[model samples]
Target: MIALNSIVSTFNPDDQQKFITYLQSKNKRRDTKNIQLFKFLIKEELSSKDICKQLYNVVQCNAYHALRKRLFQSIIDFIANNNLEDENSIDMQIIKYILASRTFLLQKNYDVAYKILDKAEKLADENSLFPILNEIYHTKIQYAPYYPKIELKDLINKQQENQKKHQLEDQLNIVYAKLTSLLNAISYKGEIIDFESELQIILNAHNIELQDSLSFKSLYQILAIANISALITTKYYQIENFVLKSYSILKQKKETEKQLFYQIQIVYLIANTLFRNKRFEKSLNYIQEMQELMLLKKGIYLKDFILKKTLLEALNLNYNNQQQKAIDLIEIAISNKHRDIEALLDLHLSLLMFYFQKEDFTVAKSVLSKFYHTDQWYIEKAGIDWVIKKNVAEILLYIEIREEDLLYSRLKSFRRRYKKYLTEIKQTRIFTFLNFAEQYYKNPEGFSTDITRNKIENAFTWTTVHKEDIFVMSSYAWLKSKIDKSKLYSTTLELIKKA
Candidate 1:
């Protein structure tokens, strides 16, 4: 798994440039070595010796180590000063003051220490930084003997209050983490067997009452658990209630930058759930809301939100029987620079689906070509388990474009690669569909029958049973469209309507 902190850093070029600029501004001599070294470290894996030889032209190990330390320190300094205007900076500054106070206390400067603690306490209280306020209270109690002017009763009361807030935050955070872990576990599986009992256990254990969610963080965490549970259990309508609750709570307050990001996530979760439920118009409305928020905030995670919004819009259009419009939107999405390689791969796949559904075999083939070329890199970049889905799409593409030889080879390859796992996951329809598709490819004229076509349509329907979560299986409709001699999109829409 990718380290959590490094995940966002993977595609952040703007932050790197800002760090370089910050370093330049900080240095009196404008030394370029540190900036160059930082850039090299980010882009490549190199030893200290390699870095020393390349940048400093020295063989001394100690000298290289010393320079490495300085370079590391410079990066830290750059990050510290980069966004002091951000709201979280209040917490950061409070911590800094607390540390300063500690240093003063150690040096026997009681006056300076108490003054620093007072400043930190005021900032913590003003910002509702209860966690930091707890720290402030502890520090004040530690120095109480040195300063008898401190009111012990008042300090004790505030400390108790901060402690309660900290406990609440901690409980919410732990519950959120557990829910997030469960969500990740079920995401790829795309099915639920008996998660309701587990979810109830979590709620009971965590004492997670939505009514008790008094803070933004607590409310967001509560909604997140509900949203993820709804997803896992396929209870999509449940997501709407949580979404509304989150929106109502968030709108009533002044959101910090962090809260806004969480709000955006709530919007995404609801829109996605609506889309899954085939509420296309409502989904599009949420998508618009998300887009407006993106335009208003332009958060650092802009690329991800844009990718999601664009994909949701495309899916809404495609499922609503607007293949060409969906294709157009996907084209625009793929043309843009994307920080998320996984989303990019997904967009390419969606584009291929649109083209294939439209029976534009030539364009579909081209999209598949692009998909194949970039696929390996995307797998490496995103660490996604795409082997089954990727191979399945390729096989379907081959079938659509009438590449009989390629279709035969791809069918064999896909079965070999995913047969065991597909069976394990009870996704036998995928294997069945591939078998039917292979038969259809070799004998298109003889492939049609009420029995056989229904079976094939059932396979397609099974593939799309979790359409909101898993990749779409367009083979059934594609085959049905071919057998029925109808438009693929219209037939797929009918199948969806029936489903």
Candidate 2:
């Protein structure tokens, strides 16, 4: 029994001679029966198919390569004789296991593959001969994927069924398409049809129940849906709710490769939503959480997440009254040049606002000069033109206030450029107020007419939708204070409370 166990244990034929010598010296394999058993064991390990034909040539009862080959063929024939289904047959299962395990190996998913192979070995033992079973088991121990305990067949089947029933892929495509259409509509650059019906379709596909027993794929789908919903509604509350729910589910699940992907997505969504809602401090917390998670999974590709986290950190610091630190971080991000252009542009815009608030024209001019030098400056032609006109006008107007030499000619030129882009600007209250503010500053005496006041009030109503930005609220309050001090004071207080 010990010899038999040793024979089964030799995984490679290179070690067969050592075992054969040990067995022969023990005098247990001098006879034909014992010699044949040894040969069979060697053949099973080597997977040789011509060993039996050469058995007659060997006089001594020792390890023979020919006998080893013959025994290997016999095992193969046995497996062939037994009908195994293509999908569920033990042979097919083993093949699929091998393929899947190889894929996981490439992905560095060793634990998952090892778990899978372990289960496969148990299943194989119930249906295969000892020689074949031993070979399969030893093969698994040698080469396994990460997380082998996760049975691929079961996971694939479950995910496939869920995907079909939920139409998750279809729903995601629809949502992406709807968002594209909505953005096009806002820009008047594409289809003008309403996307409400399509939005409904996407919302209907969200299965909150799946969150209770969330798989990695399900978590991914949920995150995608939540992000799309947030974009559609422009509401951070919905995003917060879904992200928190997804985070809870990920916490419950094992940290598999798929789960890691979901984790990254969830953290990104949370951070972005918090930033959009102007919950800067809360956003920073989520960014820190994401950074920790990424550190734990050291080799993961997280360039996008890192950039976004950096942006959030800078924005949060600025909001919390740490302007210098915020500016420093923004400069770091810019110097790295590793972030997306859009994010960089946003950072610069925020920095511009900060400088404007501080009345630091020298630094603001330097920052704006660098910004206009970039390729993105040309890309944001409309916004850049508006900012130049607006800022230049304010600077010239300030100089006039200080009783400096008034550059009326330059002011007129700036006003002309501002008016040139006025019609192209979106009808949002913020832009309208910006336009009115420019005009009011240009000629305060004539611009305080009732008609102008009514238009500013209407713009104020629209601006309230984005109450998260204190600058916008303060501007609105200033306009209202001009009309009615008591109403402006109360409204300003209310906005502060909401902030």
Candidate 3:
């Protein structure tokens, strides 16, 4: 779908309104088809053929295609200009500085040009933007013959050093791309591959070493790889040390405006890892840091990360015996349109689970309604795993609401869609969970039986306390709550207390 209507679909109602205003400013004529076409696309839920017919009411096919291309190009320009205006957006600022310097350098304004280049070089170096730094150096060296004040030999040596650093970063990028490909293969092709061994192979091929002077940009990719490994193994704690070290290094670098984006991401990763490993307080602490960073540069990255921060905060609060507060946090956040659609889906499902735990089935179903799109839509927006989770939640919700027919029908579809995927990932416990849920649906009283408990335990095994995933424990706690005839919230809290 490429997100339904390219980047336009990414905008929520608020963004749509903002884009209208932007388009108004960009429009040279009052009777323009661009706005009309945009309004039509957003207003109607029609297929391409129908849309084409409607669009061609007064225009020929060639004009329609030309108008479509112009509208698409306008959207691209709007997004580009909006990002360029971002506070402390270093790359754009550096480019602007370079352009300004080049303008003066053309007129033999050596003094002014050198000052601008100096500023650009400092900004690029701080952000470890080697390619941009090379550009700055190239301009300086290019004009060296014209300006005698600058040292040509010094500039050449500096560029040579930067080229080496850039090459190293390129190697890290190779490893990063390889890791992404490996993960995609595992999911799309259902290939069984060892995470560590595959990661090692890529690192070896790239001649990367942990002991090297890895820059912040390199560490970001490495942390991403660590996150991927943690996800595959369910051993988030294993990467804790490396992530913390990277964050510490970033902190020691003393906050560059250009590195703010990476800083926000690294802090979020730290907070997420802690939350996954059952360190709620510490996780919340880092989340506080992340939120603070987001507020910087006039909250330029806020839209990018608000949902993620809220999801983490809500999770930590919920675990700390503040379920209502957590629920309230997410409720307020979910009302707005954010760019992090993946995180939006997470919050939607998390809120649904919270309502289900509270026995607020009415509210739970309402939250479920917000996920009004198809599973294919969700799989593209989130992932296949998230889609599977949603399906399971739907089936369970149907069972809770006493919709027997819907529950059975959803079960049949869920199995048909995900049975092979579950087997590929060796996560067929989902089937076991559905089986027990079905039995419970048949006879609620049977949940208290020793045989039912035995069946549940046989299907769901645990290696140790405080190691299993929070969501896994959540589903188990729901079943346990039914078995013990206790409150779902309390059962969940007591169960995860060990983790």
TM-score per candidate, chains pooled: 0.70, 0.52, 0.75
Candidate number that wins on lDDT, 1 or 2? 1
Clashes of each: 0, 28, 1
lDDT tens digits by residue: candidate 2, 60-142: 43355444444444444333443352213555776677667657767777777666666766655443223334444454545
Better of 1 and 2 by TM-score: 1
Q: Write the per-residue lDDT of candidate 1 for residues 1-499, one digit (tens) a residue.
A: 2121243243367766777777778767755576676666666566556777887787556665665667667666555565565646767788899999999988878889989999999866654577788888998888787777788888999899888877877888987887776665544443333456777777789776655455566666777777777755555655675667666866766555645566677778778877877778888998988887775533565655888788889999898878788888989878865557767877887787777777788887888777545434544553324545667777877876677788787777667755675565456776776777678778787876787777764554342344433234345666777678788788888877754
Cα lDDT for residue 258, candidate 3: 58
* Candidate 3 lDDT by residue in tens digits, 1-499: 2233656655657668878898899888887778777887776576555666776764247776777788888888777776677534778889999999999999999999999999999988877889999999999999999898889999999999999889988887888888888877664445577878888887888788764335666777778888888887778877888788777777767466556787788888899999988889999999999989998865657777888899999989988889999999999998875657788889989899888888999999999988889887877777777788889889989999999888888899888878887886778888988888898889998678778777788877675666787778888887888788899899988987877
Ranking by TM-score: 3, 1, 2
Best by lDDT: 3
> Which residue pairs in model 3 clash with each other?
466-499
The local distance difference test score of each candidate is 0.70, 0.54, 0.82
Q: Which candidate is the best by TM-score?
A: 3
lDDT of 3 at 82: 69
**C-alpha root-mean-square deviation, each candidate:** 6.5, 20.5, 5.3
